[model samples]
Target chain A: MTLASALIRAHIRERLAAALALPIVALAASSIAMAGEPVTIRIDNFTFGPETVTVAPGTKVIWINGDDIPHTVVSQTKLFRSKALDTDDRYTFTFDAPGEYPYFCSLHPHMTGKVVVKAPAG
Target chain B: MHDPTDPNDDPTRPSRRGALECMVWAGTGLLWTLGGGLPRAVGLERALAAEASPAPFSFLQISDSHVGFNKPANPDALGTLREAVEKIRTLPQKPSFIIHTGDISHLSKDREFDDADQILRETGVPMFYVPGEHDLLDDEPGRAYLDRYGKGSRGAGWYSFDQNGVHFIGLVNVVDLKAGGLGNLGAEQLDWLEKDIAGLSSSKPIVVFAHIPLWTVYPEWGWGTQDGARALALLKRFGSVTVLNGHIHQIIQKVEGTIAFHTARSTAFPQPAPGSAPSPGPMKVPAGELRQHLGIASVSLVHGNEPLAVIDTPLAG
Candidate 1:
């Protein structure tokens, strides 16, 4: 084979490798974006378990009241508020904005929790 | 200062000292008698066990409505509260009024208060209220309760009013909630309570009502008031002092000197006896038996009665 022909073939091979790497990189990025899942905060014994939680924006946050007494999930900034939740009751709020939502049990002010929402990767 | 009638020691046996002390304070002190349209009463007996009462006025006590509560312990709390009202309406003799110990609502929401009012108002009797831990919730500390019932009340919703012949003082002890523990009646309220009662004659009958138990029912669940002893101290001089409370959601009675302490049952649900459950909360009972454990308290005061006649009749009966 001629040396010029050999160089051209090598160039073509390099181009093929580059094309293959682009999709693989794209898939990795997509997977990372898919990692966002629902988060939950447990209310038991007059406290918010996992007092702080961080999640991607649009992630649903759920509060389950395991304590015998009734409780409420109310946001400090009026972002979200749940009705009085009795034992084993559940309240869900999907945080869409990228910011912090500090919450507490309206029935018990000392019981507090926070959810940190992060922007999703493109 | 020795109070055997305090039934806090033993309801089955009324101590001789307590009976004698009661007779001394209640019996020859004054000839005044309570008047109302009630049945006849027999002469006084040594033990307060006899139903006979010196004063003819009767008042009802209801507590812990938890109107917003929708738990398994008692899903139909409002219905049960209505039932309690119905029971009160059917009494052979109408009670003068009702004094709620506390916990009118679970979440202290505006609708919760409205719901409770609708049910309680049906009984056709006025009700004096005190705040509970659940009533002074986050976002707004006591605004809902105070807006609805704070008129004529002192700081934090504590107030005193005069009935037919008795003085009723409502104390608020839930402004600051402890973490799953005991309640606190701040010094400010204590001082106000002191001055409020300072002018009353020692012979005048005093009836005090607060949400939490004035006595130490159990410290683990914050069942008792932190400064209840201080409030009770000032009330000791009165001839007939009845201190009734309702946070515990169960019936427990005691007597110390001239002061008689009683905790009434909740209209919404029942809590485990002190230390019976892992913690104090809504105690789930078997089906069809919840009403058996919940009821209102009726206090009978005769002008010179010692150890006011307290009757706890269940909603079912």
Candidate 2:
């Protein structure tokens, strides 16, 4: 084979390898995003059902208010806040940090709930 | 109008004086008879005061409502709690405040607290609370409870106040509860309690309310406070002290060194008396009879010329 042809063939092989690796990286990233577990929170009446929850960091949490009353998901540590969600309304927040986060309804001081963020599982 | 000149009147004057002295002696005897039974009469008066008093002031004692609880014992715990509040409203005398001993909710759900709050607010009386093991099931000793009902309380929801010449204290014992471990007051609260009570004179009446029984009611089920002895020691100097608790969900009274310890019933559901069941959980009775088992307590204090009397009346018969 000619030396120029050999160099061109090598360059094509390297380009082919890079192209093949790109899809795999994209696939892995998408899988991680999809693999994130969803934390479910039920809100009924004047309370947050399950009052306390334990979730892994980066988990997406969905709070559905099923009660006739309105509620606010305000974190005590100021981790996050979901503005007033009325009956049948839904709110979602992602917890990226691992710590104990206590929350309450800004409207009803007596309505309290807690979220426990745990380290990601190995 | 006396005729002093008459011989007959002069002779009768000494005799009249002697008769007056005899009447005075008779009156003294009657007064001694009444005074001899004064203590017993006062005791009887207290018993009657507990039974009947016009416009008496009382504070409600509610414990272990466990709003989110749906165990076999109580399917509708919140319903029963509402019934208890209804009973409180119909009470002849409205309570001045409501003191929740603990376990206000079963799962410590925000909804449970909401349900409990809804029922409690119906009473039209201010409410005071302490934490229970069920309330502090979260990692942060149930910060939600503190944020809502624990205003003006010290760390972990302990505080003291004075009402009608009585020193009222609210203590927190469930902060570091272990699995199947008895409630604990920890050292810091004990220190605070000592300092809090140090300034009060022994003559002042003291009422200490907490979630766990300061006295060992049932050690097997972890119904007692682990460090309650230290707390009691600080209160020993008071002439009349009352220690109130609620975790056991029943009435258990003990008197030690002039301090009376009483546990109130849960407005939500009933638990079997310590060791009566396999574990401490809701106890279901017939629907009609559930109200009889679950009731609120009204504690009244009468402060007049008599000693302070605390009367605890159950909602049910």
List the candidate 2 regions with Cα displacement exceeding 4 Å: A1-122, B1-51, B178-180, B303-317
Per-candidate DockQ vs. reference: 0.16, 0.02
Q: How many backbone clashes does candidate 1 have?
A: 10
lDDT (CA) for every model shown?
A: 0.74, 0.68
Q: Lowest summed-lDDT stretch of 10 residues in model 2 chain A? A: A103-112
- lDDT of candidate 1 over A2-111, digit per residue (tens): 99999999999999999999999988876555556678888876668899998877788889988878777888877888877767889999877789888776444546
Clashes of each: 10, 5
Error of 2 at A72 (Å): 28
Residue-wise C-alpha lDDT for candidate 2, range B1-317, written one tens digit per residue: 34576432354343221111111000001111112112112343445434454433456687878787665566778887887788778867677788888888765678888889988899898888888756754435478888887788888999998765567899998764443346788999999999998887665777799987888887765677779988988888765677888877766655555676778777667778766765454566776676666666666554233332333334454
**Which of the numbered candidates is closest to the native, going by highest TM-score?**
1
lDDT of 1 by residue, B1-317 (tens): 43465542354543322232232111111122222312123334432334344435667788889888877889888888988888888866577788888899987888889999998888888888998878877456787788899999888999998875467899987765443335678989999998999998675678898988888877766668777889988888877677889888887766666676778788899989977876676789996888878888765544322433434666763
Instruction: For each candidate, report what fraction of the true interface contacts it reproduces.
Output: 0.20, 0.00
